[model samples]
Target: MQAALQAAGQGWHVFPLRPGSKRPALHGEQSCPRTGPCVNGHLKWEQRATTDPDRIRAAWSQAPFNVGIACGPSGLVVIDLDVPKNKSKGSSDAPDGATTFKALCERAGHAVPTTYRTRTASGGRHLYFTAPPGLHLTNTAGTIAELVDTRAWGGYVVAAGSITPTGTYESLSGLQTAVLPAWLRTILQPTPKASQAPATAVLGRSNRYADVALANETRAVASAPVGEREGTLLRAARALGRFVAWGDLPRHLVEQALQEAGQAAGLTAAECRSTLRSALNWSIAHNQTRRETA
Candidate 1:
């Protein structure tokens, strides 16, 4: 561990990986049985024992500061501590079960400060953070897990190359390291500032995709609730504006899964309409919650 930190000091790329390399950061053994075939055709996301140890290490070498740890496969399900700034320095605008990530960067010395945010599967928020300078990035990752707010779940996948915006890993450019700084033994997220977008010279808006982006967001706002036909319903709602009515919602055959989820419930037409209304309401609330937390 000390050598890796020294290498980082010399600007040599390092990857702080576990023995199995399924995760870049070290996490105590935590596993749950998933008997059926895993979604990626494996048994479970966290079943590190199933992964080829060689591949886990290989993925860690993508670039300097990129570390690999054995995540039990389901990936790290961290409770992100990222939050927007409070309305005032102490206006008590903190989120429910939330912590601020912005403060950590300001406090981190000799480190290129970074803050990250991601959406949870439940439309909640997740925050990303680079390990402080001189500490192994993987080590920082491990520490942050403990610092996460109560909203987080301890176990999460630590696979590399994942585009999860909520995840934080190695350095991307400019005097980067494959590992985090060794100096930083531990860190906790900071309190947020305000929620406004940074007030830099507003570069002319990227208007080319404005229409499409709004449509997509609104469509996201209208998609099914958390526990519904998540994939199919989202696709169907995305095709909403184009369709004249529910019949046209399919707009068809995107998948063999058409309304079967609720059909077995034998809901009446009124019940269906009421259920959809409820879902729409739920989606809007969820999106709003996300926006506020984000």
Candidate 2:
């Protein structure tokens, strides 16, 4: 109860999670009784989360419920830095989220900002930040880098006092939550449709084979199903990368086309950018010899 109240004191809405688990304790939609709070309709966890002290007290009194902080209502964008689950065979140097995030910051010519931080049960870190006003950023998985995720609208975070079977979540810093940095926000923000012009305008139709390949690959990425979208985007980027290396297509144009296609298929801007960049780099490097001989 005190744990939920502390989160509520920070102006963050709180909800109950199952004791010793991260799953929500509130009745799910399928089993909603539609009584009392749900008199009109089935209220989802996000909708039912509240900052009211009475409600928090009532809910927590029944059991030692874990606290869940709803990010959307709280106006927070939490950057989750996770540790690698398991080391690959013969590789003891698996990169963790903090290391990758630090590299990402250095590449952008910035240092990681000090903010309200928490240590998760699984030995992961959560860096809390205030969201930019009026920007409704959605949750992302591996959008910024491997093991880095951002949760905003439609997502929730376990409060600092919550405990799971693995371990307990504990606060690491008392520092104020920082406003999300501009460079990081730029990566998360979606590209406006008005700015995305047709690929033909950028790439032109001079090489029919290259043009056809670009169109086909991008189309495949855009139409890929949810489970296969990321792989499709990576494959498309790799397939088109050779054309860029061979001087048959411009790198920027190919990147732009594929990025837009990946976003269209529900991939986040950061995810597309990261995947496209790595895939293209590998494809270009590996195909350099073939390009030189041609």
Candidate 3:
């Protein structure tokens, strides 16, 4: 408990985990009543996690819970090195976690700096580093290598002093959180933003006219919330419009299907008609470009 408080004192947003486990120690049972699969509550720790001393005490006082570190709030990025227990069953040529991490550092031409390290109960390692400014890193599995994962924004890592059935998460003394490496920065960073157009779906000219793209667009339109009706309709129109330009679906048939989908998604008739016209115009322009290029 004191260790958790101390971690919070050092600017880590600490939360309670279930004793002897890595799951969050949330108070209430949260489930999706309609869909039967909860979306937001599955990661409630990210929302209710805090560094406040009082909240930390209140949480831990009820039970001897393990400490969980909310990485994003703490401005920390954690490299999780997991060694598989079933390594003997896998191919011998497959490199282990340590070997993969070492090879990565070798490629970067420098050893990883000694950082605030935590030896996880499962015999894995968690190397802590300061996140780079304006670099939004999300959680990824095997992005670096097999058995290796990262916990960044929207993720949590069990903290040092947390004990579980496997073992205890113990700190490696005499180390500080180091700056993220330039090589790692390149790999872990978010992709640069580009144009807002949705990725084009490849079309084929086979006699099998299944209209799979239209079916997908219809589903998207139906599932979209009221606020997204306009954008969803526009995207659906553009996609179906492409098929029209490719001489796959007839223009009138495509327009009718789009109009039906837009109306089902709660768009006004006027809005649907106007968006349909614009999309057909876009398709006309697309065909014109193709002709000019040819």
The candidate that achieves the highest TM-score relative to the unseen native structure: 2
Count of clashes, each model: 41, 0, 0
Q: What TM-score does each of the candidates earn?
A: 0.23, 0.70, 0.60
Candidate 3 residue 279 C-alpha distance from true site, Å: 36
Q: Global CA lDDT of candidate 2, please?
A: 0.82
| Ranking according to TM-score, highest score first | 2, 3, 1
> In order, what lDDT does every prediction score?
0.31, 0.82, 0.71
Candidate 3 off by > 4 Å: 28-43, 87-94, 193-294
State how far residue 276 of model 3 sits from its true place (Å).
43
Stronger candidate by lDDT (1 vs 3): 3
Report the Cα lDDT for residue 54, model 1: 44
- lDDT, model 1: 0.31
All predictions: root-mean-square deviation over Cα?
A: 21.1, 11.0, 16.9
> Which window of ten consecutive residues has the lowest lDDT sum in model 3?
192-201
Better of 1 and 3 by TM-score: 3
Q: Is candidate 1 or candidate 2 better by TM-score?
A: 2
